[model samples]
Target chain A: MKLPSLRIYAFAYLAFLYAPILLLPIFAFNDGTIIAFPLKGFTLDWFSQMFANDTLGRAVRNSMIIAGSTAVLATAFGIFAARAGTRFSFPGKGPIMGLIMLPLVLPEIMIGGSLLLVLLAIGIELSILTVILGHVLIATPYTIAILNTAFASLDRSLEEAAYDLGEGKLSTFRLITLPLVLPGIISSMLIAFTISLDEFIIAFFLAGNEPTLPTYIFSQLRFPKQIPMIMALGTCLVLLSIILLTIAEYVRRRGLKKTGAKDTGGFL
Target chain B: MRRSTASWGFWKTLRATSRSELPKKAPRAEKWRRAMHLASFQFPLPVLSSAMLRKRAAPQETRMAQGSPLSRLKHSEAANGLALISPTALYAILLLAAPLLTILAYSFFKDGYLTVIHEVTFENYKAVWTDPIFRAILLRSLIVSGLVTLVTVALAFPIAYFLSFHVRPDRKSLWLFLITIPFWTSYLIRVFLWKVILGYNGVINSGLKSIGLIGEGQLIEDPLQMLNTVGAIAATLAHAYAPFAILPIFVALEKIDRSLLEAGQDLGESRVMTFLRVTLPLAMPGVVAAVLIVFIPTIGDYVTPELIGGGKLPMVANMIQAQLLPLDNKPMGSAIAVSAMAVVALISLAFVFANRRYLRGPK
Candidate 1:
């Protein structure tokens, strides 16, 4: 009962944080079309409608493709930058890293607008590929942030030991360094995938005719009839995100334990 | 120098002699010196001897004894690091830096019928600055973001304090995970859900009616009009960014030395006074960071204002989007974007400068 007021306040704040998201499932299964309150019988019609919509399917497929490609590409780039950043001291390192992490602070609208202008001027077609390009630009910073921890916590002597045992640099990296940071790499990819999947502004501007999940949801939000289906979709997305983030947190913690590094908290 | 020709006994002898001669250092340094010795022995060269091995093993001596600056640069660790990071650095420069510079350039150019004229002019900036609608939206964006930042950081501090100080260490990550779950979900959906909850016949109204709080004959004539207002926009943003605010403050609170508070108490100060004098000051950096994190992004938030405000109350972001896409005025959009960014940067820099005292010193 100590600090009862503060504890109650904290719980209330958590409730506020979760209230809207907790509404997703309630409306998703509601037997009525409207999202208002009342005792309506439970039904799964929204879920069925969400699954049967061909456009929703297309958007899902497109989002998965974009998220997958972005995760891999951003994580690959992250590995290079993170390894170099942690293992070696270079000239202009600060500014180089700053430029790479700039997207973290810059507004997405600015990034989206600027990139759109450049793509148009260059005569490039807008597609999921361009969306991937934009996603990689933003997601690489997060990946690098994750991988930096992974690389920094590593014992350098392990790689040197492999080299001393007559292994080449590439083999030393492949055998000694890869296994140690594999958990971190997975964590980075999952986070990057989640970011790309949930992203709306960049995809809206970049995906000319294609429908990603967020943009599709945005489009559907305009129609009153699509509310329940969108709610169902939101429930599924929220569930998927929770799963991904859980796995990411688990892998990151495991990586910390494997490296014998102190737990400094994680992305979650 | 070939590894095939070297014997274990010879290597052992070499290590013994070098270890005896070299000054004592940390074990890691000793290991590094051994690795350097091993590397020199692995070099493919003729006429290798223990003297050459000793000379090569002492990297500082050999580095000082090397040739020209360009040749030195070729083999320098900086060069290797640069080479390794080139792929990522190149992508950033091409994608992020180039596009940003293009936006800056486009902002100054003349807007043609459909095509952007290459002629550089300040008319776009002039128009953007002088427009009443742009000014109103920009001001609204600033006010809404500031309000959200204030509310979010205030609300987050106590929770962050609870997590950092009151919670058991073993369960902190679980608490953090739970807090961040809603943040990672689809933002568009979250914003839309706010509209569903706050609309005229939304959850609150219906719930109130069901409980007999409001109806046709009740004191209140109509369901509360919550949507299409700045307060609704701010509330939605504050909810979305709560975790963003909590994390920084929690980190700052975690870094404080517990002994400081105990020492303050030992000096005869009450708990409240000790907290006011010791803990709050130490947590200011996190507060400032949380402020910037919440404020910067929320000002540019396009979804919340569009959905919660029902597109009737457009922020700067909506204005920019309108100009760029719907209206096809690239120069004007670019100008507004640049102006908004400049204002945001100025405000952020000023805030940082004012709070620079707390930001200094080792974490």
Candidate 2:
């Protein structure tokens, strides 16, 4: 068809994708109890109420802890897997990597349900720690995908030269390989943090009586009075996600440049 | 070609270093150099051409004969690789594989009063398959996911095509970044926002009422009643999965050689015909991928149904959740989970098989 029509269609599709999210800030600032039309003059009461809520505060704290721990653990595991898969030949590599990536396609409900059963069967109490375990399992695949590119694009001669200069394997890796993939590591951590922060299903199933940000939002969604504050919270989360993703994309591109590799694509 | 040049530089440096530092152990150093060469050659980089792989394999047999089995096992690259990957592997086995197995095993076991019994039986699966409620929910889940996949992939194709074919190369990444931003945001919030837009007395209804379209006793008696419907659920899921559908199609389109399109035109095919015969077929693999990527996840989506459907239209996920948690029927829930997964896997495999011609290796 015509290019102009196609362009309009693209823009309209984007609007559809973004319309609900854009409505968040609009309703968040509206000075009204109920979420409806015909603009109720602008106000920041929701934001203030969101700030002053103690449960919301606790939920935010809980989410930060879970996200932070998930980021570190997932990224560390990603580094190990990425380094091994990219740099060495081994038996069962296909199946091993496949198993690691299985969570990507598996349903979140399945993962959450299965994990809940296993944890209960093993006598482990559902808590933020259990949520972390689920989050890390899901997040590690993404980190591995990102880090694999970072590790694969590296110049093998750089490491070989360090080894030839009498550096031990561990020292050579620590000094050379670590710095080269540092940006990728940072990108992976940020993405993992974002995933854990936004995750709902697993956290809902695993976090027993604990209020992570998503579960809190899910609970308050049913209340009309709490909807506006939830919108305010949603606005903040959308902004935070955008910021984190932008940084991740920037660092990923910068890493590609530093390694003198071509940019294929990124999470963005 | 670049790899060969790099390898040349590496060998030259290695030989120069060994000659200068270890003159007395030249033979041993030569053996080490050969072993290093074999090590490097064994796992060629991802970008290696088949010709390069064949050339690199010539000296592997000699290297394998030079070392004792135990000593080689200790020094082998496989040993190092396995050691490095052990932690991640163990974690996956313990958490992912073990849990999945537990779910599978539970599907066969019987549920007891507030607890699962150790006795194994097929009662849960029998119930899941025989129960009309379970069957209807599973069917609805399939229909919703299929609708989502179709709508998402169809809408995404035009945009992905525009970006790949019409947009400037310099601005493609900007378009992609814009497309993906919504997908990265909080999914719970996104689903909730849909409720605000589609709920009774929501933005559309209230806006219509203010404009004198919908009212108590005007042109319409009640609101549009958009929420708690299958259409709303499909629309929400379609929006959520749009970027995923776009990316793969865009990648496939980007891989298409422009010269082929020109060649098709030169062969007297019309623009529409060229697109239909050449572009569409070539993009099938991506379309298939987009289908699976969108279809599989939406089947398991919990938030969209719960929020948009208002708990009135419970999909398989909700059914499983109800059985497992509120009803405390572990065996039934596990059976439902396994059954849903089996259906998804079968459908995905069928799709891939149907499209195997397009997905075959490039000539």
Per residue, candidate 1 scores C-alpha lDDT tens digits across B1-363 of: 011112222344355545664576556756767766666466422124334544443454344437886777666656777899899999999999999999999999998898999999999999989999899999999999999999999999999999888887878888888898888889898889889999998999999988888788986768999999999999999999999899888988998999999999999999999989999999987888899888898888999999999999999999989998999999999999999999999999999899987765333
TM-scores of chain A in all candidate models: 0.97, 0.96
Each predicted model: what fraction of the native A–B Cα contacts (within 8 Å) does it retain? 0.65, 0.66
Best by lDDT: 1
> What tens-digit string does per-residue lDDT give for candidate 1 at A62-82?
999999999999999999988
The regions of model 2 sitting more than 4 angstroms off are B1-68, B216-219
Q: At residue B185, give the lDDT of candidate 1.
A: 86
Total residue pair clashes for candidate 2: 0
After superposition, which runs of candidate 1 have C-alpha atoms over 4 Å from their true positions?
B1-75
Pick the DockQ winner. 2
Looking at model 1, give its docking quality level.
medium
Q: State the DockQ of every prediction.
A: 0.50, 0.54
Instruction: Give the interface RMSD of candidate 2.
Output: 5.6
